[model samples]
Target: MELEGKVVVITGGSSGIGLATARMLLEKGATVVSWSRSRPKISHPDFYFFECDVRHEHSVWAAYEQTEERLRQNISVLINNAGLGIQGALDTMSPKDWLTMMDTNVNGIFYCTRLVLPGMKRMREGHIINVSSIAGIMGSENLTGYCASKFAVRGLSEALYKEVRDYGVKVTCLYPGSTDTGFFDNFEGVTSRENMMQPQDIAATIVHALQSPPNFHHVNIEVRPLMPKGPKSPKKA
Candidate 1:
């Protein structure tokens, strides 16, 4: 879809990949609406920030309602990027941590997608991008809850893609690996940022998917950093 003057709604747009995407889309002339628990730092004439918690259905609905009332436009794109992770072994992971990951990663996407589908169906054209993780594709040692939630996102995206394609709507599942974001701050395992992908790189990929020609669509994109060389040996020692 041509991005000019389009209405794009992004979840978790306060920072990181979502923030980068909002900036990029705005540069292409799209009006950007960001929904998050905290206010985004962006200030643009075409940018609207809505404080929302996507895990709650009512909050998500209210955000959409306000967007329509204020912008007077149906959303042309929906980016489900609000998610959190708590990495740990299954047995050691707290129940609260598990619920938090599931609610934020899986239920949040569901609520936001549910609210946007009706508008997209009415317009008969839209794009939905769900940000999953490499853990969604491959299981990891200490990230059971995180992996489960992401895997659910993958399944949900694929099923929704099949259901919505007939309505001229496209659904894409993005599996990004080891990006240089605060996502690692709460992680329980060791994390290395030696050769991590930048948030802008993922944002560019998302824009590319949205810019696909009318005749084609991208269903899934998996991105990862090249394997970093091992640290040099301590030969002097």
Candidate 2:
């Protein structure tokens, strides 16, 4: 599909992967719409930002309506990139924190995808990318809630593609490795932030996927840096 003048909506466009992807897409000549609770520090003629909290269905729906109304165009692509992570044992986790993680990581995707699917199906041409985590593939200690949410995303993406493929819509579930995007801010002492993948790395992969042939259906792609830094790393390396 041509990226030129394509309408792409990205959640959490204020920072990290979403921000990087938004900038990259804009560079590719795609009109970018940012749906984020926090405003982004981006300035471009083709770039627009809308304040949205994806956790609430109404908030997502309203933002979608307003964005399309303003652009006067149907979304050609959707990136459910807004995600939150809380690391704790279930018994030690607070209800508020857990809910925040679940709502942001899982429910947000549901709401955003739901709002855009009918339009995408009607158009019979669209792409949806759901950002999961490596934890979604492998469980980790003291990170059960975060893992569960990412795993749910994997499941959703797997089922989503089968449901939408015949309609010419593509669904991709991305499992990205630890990136130094303040995603580690919630964890006290885990890994060296400088040793992880960069947001631009993930952003580049997303752009490459978008540049694929129209018939190409990317079901799931896992990206990890070589010699990934773990919770306990030797100082020498």
Candidate 3:
């Protein structure tokens, strides 16, 4: 669909990928509404900011409702980017932390998607982009809970893609690896921010997916850094 003047809703828009996406979408002539628990200072005239906690169903509903009323348009695109990361060995991680991961990453997507489905079906045209992670595709040693949550997110995206394809809605899932975002602060291991992907890069990919032709529905895209080759053995001795 043409992005010009289209209304797009993005969750977790205070920072990271969502923020970057909001800016990019604005550049593409889309009217963008961004939701977060804390509102960030965005300077764009076309960008509307909404404070919302996606983990709470009411918060998600209110944000969308307000956006719809103000914009006078059902959302043409919904980007599910609200996520949390809790890192530790599964045995060492607290039950609360595990539940937090599931609530924010899994249940949050479920709530937002459920609210948007009706409008999308009625219009017979919409896009849903769920931000997953490389950990969703490959397991990590200390990030068991996070991995599980992201894996569930990817699964949900796939299921929704199948269910919504018949309704003229496109569902795209993204698996970005170790992005240089707040997510790294939760990890206990060494983190080189420079080595990881940037939020802007992932946001660009999301926009590309949004612009993709209807005949080419890229349901899933896995993004990762180039793997380092092993050290040469002393030049073959």
TM-score of each: 0.94, 0.95, 0.93
Candidate 3 Cα outliers beyond 4 Å, as residue runs: 227-237
**Candidate 1, superposed: residue stretches over 4 Å from native:** 188-191, 229-237
What is the C-alpha lDDT profile of model 3 across 111-192, one tens digit per residue? Answer: 8989888999999899999998988898989889999999998899989899989989999999997678887775576545
Model with the higher TM-score, candidate 2 or 3? 2
Candidate 3 at 17: error in angstroms?
1.0
Q: Considering summed lDDT, which 10 consecutive residues are worst modelled in model 2?
A: 225-234
lDDT, candidates in the order shown: 0.91, 0.91, 0.87
Scored against the true structure, residue 125 in model 2 reaches a CA lDDT of 90
What is the descending TM-score order? 2, 1, 3
Give lDDT tens digits, candidate 1, residues 12-126. Answer: 9998999999999999999999999988888899999888998888898889889989999889999999988887899999999999999899999998888888989999899
Once fitted onto the true fold, the runs of candidate 2 whose alpha carbons sit more than 4 angstroms away are 230-237
For model 2, residues 157-193, the per-residue Cα lDDT tens digits are 9999999999989999999988879788868776667
Model 1 residue 119 CA deviation in Å:
1.5
Weakest 10 consecutive residues of candidate 3 by summed lDDT = 228-237
How many backbone clashes does every candidate have? Answer: 0, 0, 0
